[model samples]
Target chain A: MSGFSRFTPLVNALPSTIPFVGPEAIERQRDVRVKARIGANESGFGPAPSVLEAIGRTAGETWMYNDPENFELREALALHHGVSRDNIAIGGGIDGLLGEIVRLVVEPGTPVVTSLGGYPTFNYHVNGHGGRLVTVPYVDDREDLEGLLEAARREDAPLVYFANPDNPMGSWWDAESIVAFARALPDRSLLILDEAYCETAPAGSTPSMDALIGQPNVLRMRTFSKAYGLAGARVGYAIGTIGNAQAFDKIRNHFGMARISTAAALAALRDQEYLRDVVGRIAAARERVAAIATENGLRPLPSATNFVAIDCGRDGTHARAIVDGLMEHGVFIRMPGAAPLNRCIRVSVGPEAEMDLFAQALPKVLSAVR
Target chain B: MSGFSRFTPLVNALPSTIPFVGPEAIERQRDVRVKARIGANESGFGPAPSVLEAIGRTAGETWMYNDPENFELREALALHHGVSRDNIAIGGGIDGLLGEIVRLVVEPGTPVVTSLGGYPTFNYHVNGHGGRLVTVPYVDDREDLEGLLEAARREDAPLVYFANPDNPMGSWWDAESIVAFARALPDRSLLILDEAYCETAPAGSTPSMDALIGQPNVLRMRTFSKAYGLAGARVGYAIGTIGNAQAFDKIRNHFGMARISTAAALAALRDQEYLRDVVGRIAAARERVAAIATENGLRPLPSATNFVAIDCGRDGTHARAIVDGLMEHGVFIRMPGAAPLNRCIRVSVGPEAEMDLFAQALPKVLSAVR
Candidate 1:
């Protein structure tokens, strides 16, 4: 247990904890091979054939480090968003970018605002930096936008996080409401408007890029992990004003990008037709999940993202039993960590085979849990 | 130019800078294609065929995020190095791990020590964390061990960085000397023993894992970017005491690793024969580069790494001219940034074709410069 005795006091005080336990670890711990991997909100339908081709073609070039500037990907993203390359900053993933954004703003004892149970990874980053968390609880299963704004104003918090088409509950706010919320925040408050599930959201749910591109206090995080089906590739970008974007350059690991991953992202970006087709599949899978939940005597929440949160009609313990029971049948799924929200189990959209497995396992798991 | 107004003063004071200009950036800025990519010290021999196969096979799994724990890779590495899995921490690469390490140890005004012209990326991380750098100049192009020790003790610095078989100058100390330096440092002074180039170094040059694995003050970094020929894969690991290793989990983006890159690293690790073969090729290419330097009447510094630094018989201006002139011929190479070292241009090992291009371009560039 001997360790480096000179780590900063902040680091020493922090616990070695993972924000989410990966499905692989679950499989290992449960001693059961995951027959249906519908957890973690990963796109089991997979990336486009063109993206796989690009990855294969770029395999030979893996000896060379990726361009540190990420020029090509940024240029493509800029063109796609109708902004300059300076408006975009690429990172390992949204998770990685969240850590950087937190580091840029949070100091010891700094107050930061987010939903009570929203995005544990962001909360992890905040706590890691010694920032005090000021959480606004979800209202009607959606992030309490007004409460977040109030907390930011009252605490004069420098940072706030809001996820569009949010995880766990799979809830969303309309583009107009989101824009209004951003504009209402204090000038000193930097809002991380996480749109990780944007591509899968219903039309008009995601705000237009131009709406907040000029706002220095707002950053929109989008990822290739969801609709593009490349979560494993670790490609995510933040869009903001030029100065806010450049702030990432001040502290990011310049040579940290994986070359093949970049190629995969570029190809994924270019093949929008495939993305469109995959989005269709994801929506259909969501419906299938809802049907399965309803048939199993659970209430499936309305979703704008690629997952459906099923209310198990009980408390967190009952929901946890369902989650653990599903795993026993080799069907892996996750649940929210906070009260009320934790009364439900979260299941991601996957291929029909996985959905079928979930359908088959749910009744049996529920019976056992009951 | 407007940015989020609430960034910490440390971030505001920092410049948006890259430690090294990538070759791709040079090509974009200068409007030239690199015919011979010999810059950045990346292995041009490429990763093993088995690794390419692994990548292709794993490409379908890119939709899923990599395991947060990186359990399999750690297990394999632990087996390879004769250490327990708890002794290792995985990261995006050495570059990403350095940033994490600095965050764990450094805070505003914290004093950290390193060679004056050592790895610029490490310096960038130190600066990003607001750590005050205490530098000791290289003695005869080798990182001065005694000078670094003295500076750490004088400053009572908590962190020190030492790169063995060092970069830019490609000099090395024997294992005994390295171990002695590590043992002499005070308990509170944490040492980052960067061994990124260890695989290409001469046998017996790298200390055995058991020699320093038990030391709480030392963490040795190794990478797939060099002799493993997977720079683009962005996989690096740090070896230290179990508690020191777990420290990374406190703040690292747990799911940041690219799944394909992890597979590639695992495959590369399993194919020891490919590594052996590539190491031989790298050593041979190093010799060829030195011969080319000698043929052109430049003094090639003796190197144990995968690159050679050639003294140009003049100052920084002359060396810059040679570097720029070679780039005009589509041959991309780099030189050190500081005095004395700037008199040397560093070239990475590559395939025979790239070597031939460099061989052909050197004399013409030299003649033009002269």
Candidate 2:
């Protein structure tokens, strides 16, 4: 395919690899409609009724560009976290914010640290910018903090990414340990402490904004995509020092945010009661998913996230077969990309109807795969 | 204000600046509410009722991430343009796509060419990536295409941006001229043919998709923000070669698009009758704005866009005064930023209620400013 041949060498060398194949893509490719929709870690319970109402109320204003400063959302986020508005910066989602942070810090051949099977999207951004990856493998299904810090120091990496209440594995580190990890990193190494799943994590798993607000090298990412049930809204924010927050203004697409999405996020933030309710429901669903996995003769990893990782008691291929088999049954789930973690299949929490579909399909899938 | 001290040298040297101050920011800073929001060239007429219905239908699905491939939207856009799906690349908006294209081609010190008073957001993106801009001044109140081609050739610039039915000035080149210019550019020089206002432009002002589709170096950007009245939806697409379209996959935030925004765009595209109706409304509003300018003894430049630029017959200071003066009456409008062009104040097309507000407020604001 012919293209503009003068793209920067970094771009020319990069592959067109997506971080994840969405369920919609699967439906099209396989000609099978997804019945359960339990993949991709989205809340099938959906956004709060109030957020939907807010979207409806604001739909008529769709002709105006969203506020480029994202001032209102930032102010709300700051108030919620008990920080100044200057301490917050908003973006389309954590994925978009990650790209901005990577652009701000990483250059060609710069070393970036992350868990081997960590968030693929971060790695995708780093690689897109020609940042060399120095990955530390997960230790016992959890992001190995000590190993990550060691790698950062050894590589003199300018950027390190850590996810508490991680994706894929659904493992988490407590707030104290996470704080120590951030503090241990060199001041020269900026830490992208991704707390995308924080709302669904155990109480102690996420550090308070105050704990890292003063650390210029630390940027804590939070999103409405998880516990708030607005993943499609694509709203996320980063909490850092005022200077760090302002750094995004240096390059972010000021008018890139969708106005209704901003309204949805603002509404989602105001209704903390809804958030709490959803978090409880997510926890219950995770238990149901775990129970289903165990009954299917699989081991469910302890998860403080909105999903459960089931160890199929076999190798990567076995886990892959289970994932594929379940999708054939219209129960779409995913597995880790790399090994060790790939030996487990990841299942996102959904309503009982979807969970019932999973419950009904798991035994058939396992038997077929076996 | 402290931040990580080791951001990339380019990032370190960059100033934190926004391309445009949104009306909301103006409202906050000036302690006034914008009663007539025509400043940003957003569609004040709002999106079609059908689009609002689509948004409402999909609001619950805001819990899922938008398709990473943007499959359905791309397919719809391709069909609309009579191009293949591979020829279309989706983004948050034209502003977002500009940033991506700049990142793909521009590195530190790479030369870029554009009109001196061209889109500030494009300049912001180029500057953010450390591209040196070579600007050609507009001739006769329109972008001087010949001058732009000359500068691009002289600088060996890899990127050139030209907007037809332009913003701020609302001027345009004929479709023949635009097509010839694209075909004339060196293969190494990528032409960003920004047709953001194409839907509002007169027939034959926009080049046919087939006119430039096969060219690897040309990317024509279009948005649903103008005539479709979905600026807040943040949907835009680039038409180019298959390879050019796929190049975005290397670095774009694949999941960055909001789900409801995509739904809005798809619904809006399917309802071409609404689009035709709105375009006619916009044309009528533009004529009304021009009449208002004439009544106020200002020369209204002919516009093929949703906004009109009126010559204030003075200097930048006078135009600035008019912009600020309108704000005092709760009528928000804008002006071109650079000299020559800055002698004109820009007004956007809106519903008659807002037009009446502008019409009523213009004389008093002008008198006060005088």
Candidate 3:
């Protein structure tokens, strides 16, 4: 059967393509069992045991909708960051929040500036809202903040995206550079300073919450999916000025949060000891992945995130082959979607056992691709 | 600090109003402890023990992202309904799906039809998308199907919303009439036949899935939130043609679902025995609520849902007083937003204890209002 004929012109023009193909889809399409699940930058190290306990305890309360205002979670996030609750807006994840933010600003033909392949999901939202994307290439594998600012100015764009401690390359700019970029951007250009990987970033890499919290044009995005090890819980928040925070109230799915996910996030936040220990383990896993890549004659990029992007010493085709070959051996990993960046393969840190699987498979896959 | 000044005109024009006030918000605002939560139509009888067990088992797996395609859940639902997997599109919940559908069909000034005092969340999405709403008032406390059809045709509205076994009034139309309404609608008007309360509805009241599955102009919204007792899990789906289902991919947050919630839903679907038991409990609780209303000299509306709407034999203000009075007694019951319907108070079914609390509290609350 056909779809309804009356979908808006923008929706009709939008492609049906998804932002990212999940590892599960790959498993089905390739008919391969994913033995090592470290492809999506999700923490295979897992959430705290206390978080699991909270989910179990809250299991019976699954019938009640989460507070539409997300008061408790926002309050917890506020206290954790020393901001007012009004400064935070909770969402399903950074992906969901990006969609809402895009809808708020992007009209048909509006230019939205971002690094060429920063995050496909953000780009997906811009396109979904009929915004024209003005791309800036990565400089030294980090998001080109200066280029993004210039593009925003050139186009008088309302939206510009920069992911500090960037994905698909595991690159970052220090806190000072980031703050300067935020201050340099035109007030008309709303900056999405995505810090999804901030937790795993080096100490001086992320700016203090106070550094840009009062900035009207900047919103910092954070998620529990990465270092918090609760990707499946789908909890993410945006921190900015109170006005920017409540702007989400204008369009967000207010009751979109899952009760169990919220409970898990609260538990995850309360157990900072678990978080500290997990950060350490993620550091170790990164080293382990880098070592495996180095032994396979690949150069591992300096990373401030949970994943390592290894330069395959070849073109995109070769990198693709290695990625496909590794998946054949059940070592599922991802790479950058666009070229220059696609010459590298990205591997996420997981439990030691997954590292072992990747370690075992990489040598053979690299040789086969070579 | 203020928000970015360049939000679209539509966004600036939109109000930041939420659709529903959560019980938590009420408790905070009213400074009262809620001992009975029979206000939001949540199943206080809770999800099956088996669903809880599934959540516990899946807790450790929360670190992994749910399958972005939601292939497993879709396949399960397809099997359950004897439909093609392509017929189903999963979402965070019906609320989330409504937002996506509105984005697809409604643009600025686009006419969208719905019942007056219908699902506020649906209206919320329409307003968020800048769609102009043309609402048809209820006839005899039931949604006026003919009125909605006339409005859709007259306004050339691309979107029309109807909930079967409806909310606020707990009224329903027969399967034949609903099918006829769908068939009679213009092809340009996409009907959102919400079946959130379908499971609790009488068997003949719900049309077979085959009845309208082939209609491109019709989409059925179903939820595990109501009878299946997974409101907090935020699992809902839209059943339509393959084309309509795939349309969601153009704009949805592909990774929005919570992994544990998906697991819980799969477990809930598998435990149909538990579902049958809960349906019976809901029916009995409906009776319990009706009796409480009758004993208090209020008239209970005939219900095809998990809640009963009781007419207080007065105006909206009097009903509002009784509702507020019930809250003071720690019984959280809600009333309709508009007049006529607002003359009735809606009470959701829960466990016997909650019913007992309501039974005991109703007389005092009613007399106090009097």
Candidate 4:
């Protein structure tokens, strides 16, 4: 446990832990292989064939450093979103971007606001920067916009996190309500509007690109990880005003991007036809997941993302037992960590073979846990 | 210039800037095409064919996130370096790891030490974390180890960076000297022994992996970007004690690695035959570059790296003109930033075609600049 004695007090205070243990780690830790890898919200359907081809073509170019400005990718993203290229700042992924944004805004003991059990990675970053977390509990299993606003006002927090089509619970707010929340928040409290799951949301549930682009205090996070099926590519971007985007230049690892990842994202963006088809497939898989949960006498909550949360009609222990038992059968799935939300076990959508394994395993897990 | 009004005071005071202008940016800014891309110290010979094949095979798995633990890759690297997996920490590149280290050790006004004309990206990260820089002047065009040791003691610096077979000047100290310097430093001053160019250094130059492995405060950084010729893959690692490696988990983006990039690194590491071959090519190219510079009446410094630094017989302004003049002919090269070092124009070793372009253009460009 010995470490460099000179680490800043803030880093010293933080725990060495991953926000989420990947399925690969689970396999190693449990001494069992995960056959059905429908756990990490990755697109088991995979990226467009064109994206793979793009990666293949770019392999020779891997000897060269990627363009530090990320100019070409930003240009393509801007055109896709109808924003100026200056409004886009790319990073390794939303997780990496969250770290940078926290560094820019949070100092020791600074107040930051988020849902009590929201994305743990963001919370990790805030805690790493020595920020005091002002948590607003999720209301009825959805991120409570009103509660968040109240906490931000009361604490006068400088940073607020709100994710549309949220993870873990897979709930969302309408485009109008999200826009209202962003507009009504105090301008001094910069908002990180995480739309990482917005691509899989029901139509009109996510705001248009133009909705918050002009708001200097609101930075929207989007990724090619989920709907684009390039999770391993590590490509995500933040959309904001030019000034906010430029601010990333002050602290970001300017040449940190992987060349093939950028090419994969660009190709994925260009192949919108494949994205539309895959999104439909994702929607169908979500339905299949919910149907399986219902058949097992569990209540599957409505989901706007590529996953479903099934209520086990008990407390966290029962949910935990079900999760552990399912993993015993190589049917990997996750559950929420905090109360009320932890009453449900979360399963991400995947190919039907994996769904069949989950369906076959869930009944036995439920009975054994009971 | 509208931005989030609540950025930390340090962020508000810092200017948004890229540490280095990439060749792509220079091409765009100068409104010319880069036909001979020999700048940035990237290897133009490219990675091994086996590495490319690994990337092709790994393309299908891009849907899944890379293992957050980075277990398989870590095991491979540990075996390669004759260390335990706990002794290594992987990052996006050396650039990204530098940022994380700065964050861990630096707070506002924390004095950090490095050579005055050293890597700009390291300086950028230190400043980003609000660490005040204490630069030791290079003695006889080499990083002054005694001066750096003195500065660390005087400033009580928590961090100090020393690169072997250095960039911008291609200078180095013998391994025994470097080891002695490390052992003599205050244990409180963490040493970042950057050996990014070590793979190409002459025999007996680089200290063995075990030399300082037991030292808690010394972390040695190595990259596949240089001699392995995988600059765009963004794979770098730090070799240190178990404590220092695990400390990265307290804050690093756990899933930030691109799957294909890891595959490439693993494959490239396995192909040491190719590495030996390319190192030979790099040496020959360096000779060619030095010869071209000498023939043009410039003084080419002795280099143990994949690049040569040629003194242009004047100050920085004269060297800058030679660099710009070469760019006009699409022969892209760079120059050091600080005075004394700025009298040299740095040129990376490349394929003969690029060297041919540099050889063909250097004389004409020099005449024009003169």
Q: Which candidate is the best by DockQ?
A: 1
Restricted to chain B, the TM-score per model reads: 0.99, 0.99, 0.99, 0.99
Ten residues in sequence with the least summed lDDT for candidate 3 chain A: A361-370
lDDT of 1 by residue, B111-212 (tens): 999998789999999999999999999999999999999999999999999999999899999999999999999998999999999998998899999899
Interface RMSD, in order shown = 0.8, 0.8, 0.9, 1.0
Q: DockQ for all models, in order?
A: 0.91, 0.90, 0.89, 0.86
Cα deviation at A153, candidate 1, in Å, is 0.7
Each model's lDDT comes to 0.94, 0.92, 0.93, 0.92
- By the lDDT metric, which is better: model 1 or model 4? 1
Could you give the DockQ of candidate 3?
0.89
How far does residue B165 in candidate 3 sit from its true spot (Å)?
A: 0.8
Which is the winner by DockQ between candidate 1 and candidate 3? 1
Q: How would you encode candidate 3's per-residue C-alpha lDDT over A88-168 as one tens digit per residue?
A: 999988998898899889999999999987899999999898899999999888888788888999999999998989998
TM-score of each: 0.99, 0.99, 0.99, 0.99
How high is the lDDT of residue B147 in model 2? 98
- Residue-level lDDT of model 4, residues A222-253, one tens digit each, is 99999999999999999999989998999999
Which candidate number maximizes lDDT?
Answer: 1
- When 3 and 4 are scored with DockQ, the better candidate is 3
User: Per-residue lDDT of B1-370 in model 3, one digit per residue for the tens?
Assistant: 4888988999999886889899999999989999999999999988999998899888989999999999999999999999999999999889999999999999899999999889999999999988999999999999999999999999999999999988889999999999999999999899999999999999899989999999999999999999999999999999999999999999998998999999999999999999999999999999989998899899999999999999999999999898899999999989899888999999999999999999999999877777
